[model samples]
Target: MANRTAMIDVGGGFRAIYGAGVMDRMMEDHVHVDHCYGVSAGSANMVSYISGQHGRSHTFYTQYAFRKEYASFDSYIKNHNYANLDYVYGTLSNHDGENPVDYEAFEKNPTGFTVVACNADDGSTKYFDKSDVSYDNFDIMKASSAVPVACEPYVIDGVPYYDGGIADPIPVQKAIDDGYDRIVVILTRPKDTVREQKKDIGPATILKRTHPEAAEKLMNRYQTYNDEVALAKEYEKDGRVLILAPESMYGLNTLSKSFEGLERMYRAGYAAAAAIPAFLGS
Candidate 1:
């Protein structure tokens, strides 16, 4: 059977709600993320203030650190005007503060697994317990055969966006030894870093130039593949299952192409979340 991949696009609205308390407090006078605005928002009447301000004004500047300048929720419904603050953080951090959340502890918990870690330039990383999962390592040969068995090896190296090197090969091998059938070796890509460089376009010449960072990413991907291919070959003869090239499975298009490729490989299976709406009630 083929493995179905699920690509859930949690809209930005969802994101805002998830971090609403944090944001509301940041708008208060002298609000600062570093200074623990999170706790202050909880203690303050942020929800009340926002609810009261609904349909009232375009820009509602409340006490220190709290500014609801967005157009949607106006408590008193007034004119539509946009006002940009000099620097949002300067106002928030300099205001009243609180204790910062223990992100490390949060990450260590099982719930933290769902909290994604998106790198600065938009490249992201996901966590997996090698004990339960064997990923694709971007090796074409190993992945080619493993598709029939629903195995995938992959790695996301932050090449140009980062250092373009594998994190630690020991952990990967340990997972395999612990019974994982495949492995994914993530390496950062040059395209990501180049994309970051192009965040603010100033000169056409600079934009036209080939990004050396992207090249480094490609090179690293190739090198990583070479290393993993040898490892996969050694394991395959030992009877462990494998399939699905890393790039084909988790490449630029991610779930889209990977699902199709895996489907083609098995010719008898459904996607991971064929029963998604059953759970989401969407």
Candidate 2:
């Protein structure tokens, strides 16, 4: 059996709803994932996947994601972030009674799982695996999903960490380095769709002025996304890497909150999974 792995990229906000569909289809197809890597919003989905919880991710995205409490303007004023970090943290911690993440299952599963987060102090990448027992699994997930400025950094062991996407969005190299014989990549955007540079004068702008090094790391993530795609493509010819991306965004973006858009993205992801070749034999 090939050591197959899935590397889910940061989809941001509701865009990550799509990944739930992909995971659902993979489960239906009985794709044996030996390992998983996820960053940013992808980290949340990764937890559900590792837990072997069928339809739990889908339920969270469709039924629970739009609650206004998750994104509160009052919280933004008080915490410099619209995301109710506490609420999100509690949800991931399974404290709110919503489809709670099965952390016990995650710990017992033989499949390897790794969540990536960005170091706030040095702008470096941090990989948290099951062996990293210093922090709870939900805390690692929260840290991996913490968007700079949009959400406050999550501090673990006295060190602050932000979105893993800031340092490594796709993290294909990490999967390769882990000795996965074949890698399946799940991307939120369409293939070849590189992000265009834009000037932002929001809280992020303030971050740039205050912490140039960390801001530089954030700015370079665009190139990192592209570079990771290129690396995956280079390996495609030999059948080592398979990339899955949405055929069209359908006007859905990272911040889109419409239920219709979320449903569409989820369906798109389920449909895209039909393209998964028999690279990992059943």
Candidate 3:
């Protein structure tokens, strides 16, 4: 029914009755929906900020924006006949297709806060643990029931950086020079260290933590975001780059700052929500 709901009523009904039976004597064809709408992984942090941020004004405004953007997709499916043929969304199931790895919380949290969450597959999670899993081999643990991934990768050949994090200053400047009017960089630390005293475990266990190759690869992926941020700020482009650091051990706050110190992250998120579209556009 779900699959049939996507086709035109006539087409679907025909398929339900004569099409399948007649084709059964000969051959059958399979069709699949390839498009969908949902909260982008890029915007998850922004959504969390809207929910947890301080100040009712900021929260309400950000929440409204979120609802508007997300709801637009729903409206799109309703008005467009072809939309149902595409994969419309019901949930943010980004991590649905990965093996459940453990989240190890043994890392040092200098700021006593954790703002980012890391999963094994796509370095999408905030932090990676050397002792737990390496970026390359981590795909082995993807969940069995993962939804058929439909989104294509965003690729740029000439640019040196791959994967997400704050764009480094030089590249950022180049992007701006090429006509990116305003740029906002959202930053997050790895999860597992939500607070000073509370250590969160990763999704996987460590069978071998001392592997040098795995450790180096994991460290590079984890450290590059900060390195890019520092490099970006060095370019001196007024406010060309707005850095959104959250108030959690998972973010940029150092241990001395205290988890409470990370409160600014929420505000940063709210500010970014208001600024991202305009910032990215102009």
- Cα lDDT computed for each candidate against the true fold: 0.22, 0.74, 0.25
Show model 2 residue runs off by greater than 4 Å: 133-137, 199-204
Give the best candidate by lDDT.
2
Pairs that collide in candidate 2 are: none
Selected candidate, larger TM-score, 1 vs 2 = 2
Task: Name the 10 consecutive residues with the lowest summed lDDT in model 1.
Answer: 34-43
Which of the two candidates, 2 or 3, achieves a greater TM-score against the reference? 2
Off by over 4 Å in 1: 1-174, 177-215, 244-282
lDDT of 1 at 55: 12
lDDT, model 1, position 263: 28
The TM-score measured for candidate 3 stands at 0.29
- Ten-residue region with minimum lDDT total, candidate 3: 5-14
TM-score of 2: 0.91
Reference-based TM-score of each model:
0.23, 0.91, 0.29
lDDT of 3 by residue, 152-190 (tens): 122122211112221121134333444433443433432
Q: After superposition, how far is residue 158 of candidate 1 from its true place, in Å?
A: 14
lDDT of 3 at 75: 39
By summed lDDT, the worst window of 10 consecutive residues in model 2 runs over 195-204
RMSD of 1: 19.2
